[model samples]
Target: MLAHVTVTGRVQGVGFRYSAQQQAAQHNLTGWVQNKADGSVELKVEGPEQKVDRFLEEMKAGFTQFIKVKQIDVDRFNKDEGYKQFSIK
Candidate 1:
């Protein structure tokens, strides 16, 4: 499973990408996270259904002190990008 996620709020320059990368690693997920020009954080993660869901849950729950997750828009699909590891892009 793959999830294309957009996180909005106090996300930019607040260690969101790195935090997300760590979380993804914890979930054994593979993909990438990047900061968008629109002040949002965009992430693509691929893994098992349960792990992906857990990763999303952690995202919504605010994994770090600096990250205040106000909203999350996720589009889930059955596509694989063959990512070898989670990273910050």
Candidate 2:
């Protein structure tokens, strides 16, 4: 499974990207996280269905203490880009 996630509200310059990378690694997910110019964080994650769901759940539940996730928009699909590892861009 693959998911594109857009997170908003106090997401930039607060170690969100790095935290996300670490979490993704913990879930054994592959993709990347980046800070958008509009102050939102964008990420793509691909892996098993259960792991992806758990990752998203953790994200929505404030996986990192520094991040305050006010909103999350996710688009799920099956297209595989074959990401080898999680990264912060």
Candidate 3:
């Protein structure tokens, strides 16, 4: 399974991407995370359903002090992006 996630509000320049990468690695997920031009963080993750859900939960709850996720956009992704490991992009 693949999921595209967009996180908004105070998400950049606060180690969110790095923390997300670590969480993804812990979940054994493969994908990428990047900062958007609109001051948001975008993530593309591919893995088992349970792992992906766990990753998302971690992102939501783990960085509560630095990140205020005012909006989250999640969608089913359908593409063979050939990601080997989670990374900050």
Best by TM-score: 1
> For candidate 2, lDDT tens digit of each residue in 3-88?
99999988887888888888999999999999998999999999998999999998987677887999999999987789999998
The global C-alpha lDDT for each of the candidates, from Candidate 1 onward, is 0.93, 0.91, 0.85
Error of 2 at 82 (Å): 0.3
RMSD for each of the candidates: 0.7, 0.8, 1.6
Put the candidates in TM-score order, highest first. Answer: 1, 2, 3
lDDT of 1 by residue, 1-89 (tens): 99999999999988888889999988899999999999999999999999999999999988888889999999999988899999888
Q: Kindly report which residue pairs in candidate 1 clash with one another.
A: none
Candidate 2 has a TM-score of 0.95
Compared with the true structure, the alpha-carbon lDDT of candidate 3 equals 0.85
lDDT of 1 at 17: 89
User: How well is each residue in 7-67 modelled by candidate 3, as lDDT tens digits?
Assistant: 9877898888988888888889999999999899999999988888888887777465776
Model 1 error, position 3 (Å): 0.3
Model 3 residue 50 lDDT score? 82
